[model samples]
Target: MLALGLNQFRKEHFWLYHVKPTDPTTYAAVGVILLSIALLPCYLPARRATNVDPMTVPRHE
Candidate 1:
């Protein structure tokens, strides 16, 4: 659907040709980068949490 929408054009259009297919190497690199980015927030908090002692946190009575 996305490909179709991108490829579909009006009479006066900036793009007339179909977009080039992504290279496997490029795709793999992008996938790895995206995975790392997506996991960053979770990773940092988990790492920080592991390093901290929960007992040190102040408890509200």
Candidate 2:
């Protein structure tokens, strides 16, 4: 829904940029890049946490 709104807004201001606001390739590329960026930090920590013993986590508290 937000993407649609942004796209509509961008379409209105389309002359300001080179690429089309509704381009699927650009949207896909950006979505992948953003998803990776968002997931990386979370994944790294969770991956590291999985290596620890469940009992050890309680001991620290």
Candidate 3:
């Protein structure tokens, strides 16, 4: 619904094509941003799991 409205708004206002596609440097920057976002969750979870309370959970089955 909102997408349709926005498309109509862009057509009426001629705003959609105002910005050009990013350059190579911008692509590199976006790639770095995406890579960092992908890795952050894995790193944070691994670090948190390493600090788990030793007393609360058995080390062996």
Candidate 4:
């Protein structure tokens, strides 16, 4: 779902998309936008997450 949404968004916005196609500029713009959108989820923070202690490691005794 997320993948589809971001893809459409990129095509519409950054690409200045066209119906006939064959425009290199539009294609390049779309590609760049899609890549950026794909990376967005990896970098964004969770809405309700709290910071954990740096010194504490999980599953280690």
Best candidate (score: lDDT): 2
- Selected candidate, larger lDDT, 1 vs 2: 2
Stretches off by above 4 angstroms in model 4 are 1-20, 45-55, 59-61
Reference-based lDDT, residue 44, model 2: 97
Q: Lowest-scoring 10 consecutive residues by lDDT in candidate 2?
A: 9-18
Candidates by TM-score, descending order = 2, 1, 3, 4
- How does each model score on lDDT? 0.62, 0.83, 0.66, 0.60
| Reference-based lDDT, residue 38, model 2 | 100
Q: After superposition, how far is residue 10 of candidate 4 from its true place, in Å?
A: 21
**TM-scores for the candidates:** 0.51, 0.65, 0.47, 0.43
**lDDT tens digits, residues 1-61, model 2?**
5776678755867646577776778789998999999999999999998999999889999
Count of backbone collisions within predicted model 1: 0
TM-score: model 3 vs. ground truth: 0.47
Ranking by lDDT: 2, 3, 1, 4
Q: Could you give candidate 1's per-residue lDDT for residues 1-61 as a string of tens digits?
A: 4533553454235334642343355557867999999999999989988986677765632
In candidate 3, what are the lDDT values of residues 1-61, reduced to their tens digit? 3544455545645434563242355557877999999999999989998898877678553
Evaluated with TM-score, which candidate comes out highest? 2
